[model samples]
Target: MQGNSEVLVIDDHMKRKQQVELLLQFIGEPCKLVSSANIGEVLTEQVAWRAVVVGQVDIGSPFELVSQLAGQYKAQPFLLIGELGDCVADLPNVIGSVLEPFSHSQMTQMLHRCQDYHLKAPSKTKPTSQHQEILFRSLIGRSGGIQQVRQLIEQVAVTEANVLVLGDSGTGKEVVARNIHYMSARRSGPFVPVNCGAIPPDLLESELFGHEKGAFTGAISARKGRFEMAQGGTLFLDEIGDMPLNMQVKLLRVLQERCFERVGGSTSIDADVRIVAATHRNLEGMIDKGDFREDLFYRLNVFPIEMPSLSERREDVPLLMQELIERLASDHKVTIRLTERALDSLMEHTWPGNVRELANLVERLVILFPNGLIDVNDLPSKYRHVDAPEYDHEYDESLLEQDMLNDVFQNDVYEPPESSMSTQLPPEGLNLKEMMTELEIDMINQALETTDWVVSRAADLLGMRRTTLVEKMRKYSLSKDSA
Candidate 1:
């Protein structure tokens, strides 16, 4: 018998089971076939199976069949043998099923289909030895948007043009900024990071430009600011939109003349540093409202690079989670392995906080499920609603269809209600209207924040027809900030 060699023929009719087994044997996939009408009896078995030939009559209670199969062989692949509408589409572990009274060719085809499903199953795709080693370092991507970001980094890193990395918080803007600097001529120089929004206004001036002794109350000694210390290197200014107006003037001067001076010193020091600024704010909108300088906006925006959010690249979630799990395990000296179901749960979450949130969750899971196999039960109660499977935006039509079919055949026949259509798991108790309001507000704010309140780009972020998002913006009584 092949390693995964077991089959269950579920039907009330014993004769039908015999007929199907004979057909399966003729197809050269002979295996032990158990026929039972009672699902409880079938699932109670402690054996592993590759496929289940369920009859059309048995699909009304698909989970009984799924429960029987999945309970023991949840990881094992499934091929349903039944008529359309007969096999429940929501059954778990089912790869694909066929209509009943199958033909010889159909039996052979179903066998091949099951094999294909098994091959593509998550377990089979576990990272290779070399891949596992470099998984974390690979920048986690399985989507076109991310691929484009990586390509841009590779393309722009070789040039000396200043780059403005744009994205929401936790979207890896700094990572992209760093990659650009390292890939450029400044690789040998130190990469200094300064959070523009975090530093106080008065101090920020002296921090970036340095200060001569006796310049301010604490200026007991002359100190080299970030610009001088980062000379011949790259200076990453994070959250640049929050810099005070006066500071923006000095920054614009430095960018324009490529030279600046200490707060109290007259000597103009050469600012030989490459500027890579990023923000979760919309500088353009600030400029339009006269809060930011238009000239400064034009200067820093010479080469803009937008980072895609984790939701936009859901395909990479599993790979990224696995990578994070391994790294966390190694770091904390733990041996952690996720059950197939647990991994699925993690992938299903929307991750509004993006990669940073995912990383935190993985670390938490490690502490929670160390040594033991991390199964679906290990997942928090918020994730266990059977009706609401988690939704992943990154999944394509094929994967979604497959997931739907899997959900049909695997579960005990329950579906979530009153939640968003794309959601897979049950609700996390968020009120629908409130959630929509929040989502709308976030998208609008994020768009305005990123595009500097450029209506067209903000519209793009909301994914609504631009006009529609604008209408909603007016309808929802929302703004970047309240009056």
Candidate 2:
């Protein structure tokens, strides 16, 4: 087989080669099958093949041919046709094994697996400076907090140390991980991101590590897992705090030994990949609560980077809004502009969801105003009170305190008190309970204003649960219109 044949079958026995060819035809996939008697002859030819099927008898050694082909063409997947006892199923690039005298269904399934592997293979092309620039531009911000994150990324991108990104949800943890991968030496390799919380616990093992054919029910054919796909690349374990305790132990072993066996296979394959895990959950707290393994925590926290929330870097809001608007316009063709007052209102509000919330609001505005200008009046009601001053019941007392301190310092008209409580009180004593209530109300109002009356987000800002925040709002009789 030479040139552009999609499938190559190598078997020294003419009858076996013919049977393989007929099986390929029976599958009804439009692939040209090239039969070869010698591995040497096939290796000498120049061809781009989707997959290769090699018989054990043709190569004398059980796995030598498969290993050689895997080393030569790392992108190409191999299906070994041999007896169950002599199968070479442990190789990194070997997709599966079809036993001798295999049924037609087995041959069809193996061929399909090979095609899936070929399609999912990462591109080998090197990224250009322009591509890197685009990725950098996606992280738009000029505030000190964001600049520090950028500097931290620059400092750590060239190293092989495992990274642990800590931040609240919607703070762009995955974006940071991708930036590190693209800026590192493994830029050309695959960057596979897996959400640990999204997958079911039962299937997560097979999802991370390959499983042998018939290893479990519904596992029709052997498959190369994420680790194999991410070889020489990076594996981003997003929401890793949600990983089960059992899986955490297995993950720790892989990190320590740099090798892992497939779900049902005995051979251990080297994990030639960097690990970058991120989570919005508080892992340290989880460890203290006995939900997370402390040893695993230390292993992943070797090089930690914290992402700043939107409220922490409010100065970058305008720049972020501009970049987000441009991106939306270019990507979705839904352009819109915010008036200065509208921008000011957005900047004043606290962003509990951070950049993600801003992005969502921008998209919503784009859809509502489409290629138009959004003024302050266009804003939702929750954000309309940004210009209003907070109600402070202690304002008079604060002014009195400032005046008394000024009198003492500038006019030298005040005498020192004999004791801490010796100074005479005002005509009326302070109502401590009323003052406390006022302070609580002010804080709740601020949280509501910042989050645009999103109770869940406001609760996050106040370090409380959504239900508790709702209860407090009811006690204070607070409403979006009132705030």
Candidate 3:
């Protein structure tokens, strides 16, 4: 509690209890200490606590108070003050305890977490109807198809129904599954994704359903598979249409029974897992061809979700490009900008590989032209719909330089000189930062030399602020004597 909002605290010790009270008062937060008598009234009240601070005198049972509160209110965020008692890891919502003497920063940070929980707390009767921006950020589009996909994802995420995502390759099926998992009741649980097509046909069963010790020659020790890994969470089965016919029967049984046994193990292991399966291929067509079992199809296709291809939602390309670029920039520590013409050209060309293809192209451009502006001509030949001027194209040769120079100052028609830059990159990748640094140094040197080392004149020639040039000069340790 960092404000007037009341926070519930369960502390048996008097000294620690007084200290907590002082700290809460210092932070301008009101706290209600729950004792044995008023525990019922405190919980039964129609007020939402900022958070519950747990401080038990008995180290023997650190989770005793937590268990009691959790029983009463399952969603209450518990902050373990002073000691991170044993079994704290078992509970996902438990915040780490403060050290012996709780510092202002640490206490405030923990309380801030409680405040966040309060802001995003779900409704008691139903799963949170509020569309958290962070949760649905992956589904970025204003088109009817993408909106419908998002609506469907939101609708199905709150329920226990198995999701079947149908789409073309690279339509972000796995993304949908993830949103569902994070938005569902089992959000704290793991999110395990397994590509059904990637694993070998013979090894598929062992990959999904764990193999016991001595189950097979490779099974040196017992190993938990995806199903076990995602016990309380969602297990994303990608390319479900590609699962072997024999494996499909086993999966169908597990889905129906809500339990399974490890390979070569008799005892049934409860699979408290939610299944979200995706497939680009036509399952109905596969069933007609006798490649897929109809019974299994029915089991998985409970909540059907269809993802729109890139072509279907071409309007989202610009937004997708921006999102992908920002993500990749953070990853690579560099960025690229796409011009309107470039975006228009990309939109014109049909995306056969969908969003995945667009992501790849954005990544490629970031690598090729780091911190540079991109135009239609800079795109690959296959992706390019617009062309740049060629050297062979007929134009006035003698007056070209003078005419262009006049056009630049008069008409403000200056554009990047594509011909001046290297037409081809090396087979072995070039160092973009190093190359840029060297070019900057050379340009600066030329500007300084031409301007007779006059800092202001040189800065003007470079089209940069005098202070910026001075900083750069200092960074490079440049001096007139050295020059």
Candidate 4:
């Protein structure tokens, strides 16, 4: 209860100030109460404050002021006393709020929450140069969704709890995992990433847990698996839902026991690495279908973070595009500029593949139009129109029939053309399958052409998954060069 501990209050209204003082006394805490009518005056004082409470009359923009102060004092808790709707309580640093004319219980509750938050908050420390760079590069957006994700990462990075990143493919789940690792106490350790979906089901076990020499026919030498390589660090399991059911059980056991034995090796190894799993697939759905283990799901779902889709954070598209373009220019030495209209077109499109789709488009544009300016018309046809589908049909059968009857009655004409519906087929007969295949190929080729062979975008235009499009391309043996 107190020596140097103090609560800073900012309220121009005398009555509100007295009420806050009364609440502090009622709480029976011996902390000093510092009152200020001006925010500038309170900020100038070099005092270590435990908490800050700002009322409506203290500043024109109470939420903005609180946000600024919260950033300055990361360990200090902030409370806004104003109209409920006027305060933005969603901010990460804001512990709670006390509405005007608050009751004794409400005021006491808010004070307790603030004090608790201040005690639990992490101490502010300057990040190293490497950490700063990693943090900046890993997350690159000012959108609310991205900001919230950043806040969540900051809150959970210090803990050793498992994190499950949920998002559509290309939403930067791995990036988030990396940020968490670098920001955590394990920053000096290795950060290994494994794509569970890309690895073969048979080989995945050995890849994760390692296989001793002579474990299988082709086991030439002993090799450390991802888990071993990620000791004292973080192991990012990308596309964890794609992991086999048997592997899930093994993984669950490893997680529960925190130890694992290599294939064909009886000696168990300590699993010291942190687990950060990511997936585009719905693991819950897989669990319901008995494809994924329920126990394993609960194990990885301890601290779940859902990444917002590109469509959900479209406002960040322009910034993301610029960052991608700059990165491309630096890495590939290719420069490309998008006109205002072209930028607008990109922002308007529904990015199904998220940031990965956007980055691919930027790279493709740079390659196609090196050191050139791209306009709205230069964008893919899908970007130019709201409806990207190639086929559209509108039928009015009644009008067509009426027109036919009118022609018969008014003109007394009853002539049917040689190519009428009944006699449209040629004497040699049409190869329906071949014709349809050709049409399909042509449309696919067109989609590919427009998207510059970016499979995900092309699939979006063709109304299919990227994998489905790839399969069709393989079926047709179509490549960008061939197209």
Q: Number of the top candidate by lDDT?
A: 3
Model 2 agreement with the true structure over 95-129: per-residue lDDT tens digits: 88886544443564465455555445554412222
List of clashing residue pairs for candidate 3? none
TM-score of each: 0.53, 0.54, 0.56, 0.54
Residue 186 displacement (Å), model 4: 1.1
lDDT of 4: 0.71
- When sorted by TM-score, best at the front, the candidate numbers are 3, 4, 2, 1
Steric clashes per prediction? 27, 1, 0, 0
| lDDT score, candidate 2, position 481 | 76
RMSD of each: 19.8, 28.4, 21.8, 22.4
- Tens digits of lDDT, candidate 4, 419-461: 7436467899998779667867988999999999876688789
Q: Which stretch of 10 consecutive residues in model 3 shows the poorest summed lDDT?
A: 404-413
lDDT of 1 by residue, 122-167 (tens): 6443211111211123265545687677667767776778888888
lDDT of 1: 0.65
Candidate 3, residues 1-483, lDDT tens digits: the string is 111246677777767777677566533356888644456666642545666787764443447767656556655667876566665656655756766545433565576565456545565512243233123333776566987887887778879999999999988999888888877888889999999999999889989988899998989999888999999999999999999999999998999899999898988999999999999999999999999999999999999999988897775676577667766765788977665447666866799999889888988998898877676778998888644443332444333323312312232232336885685789998997697777778788899999999766787798764435654676677768898
TM-score of 3: 0.56
- Report, for every candidate in turn, its global Cα lDDT versus the true structure: 0.65, 0.70, 0.73, 0.71
| Candidate 1 stretches greater than 4 Å from native | 1-138, 383-483
Model 2 regions lying over 4 Å from their true place: 1-138, 387-483
Question: Against the correct fold, how does model 1 do in TM-score?
Answer: 0.53
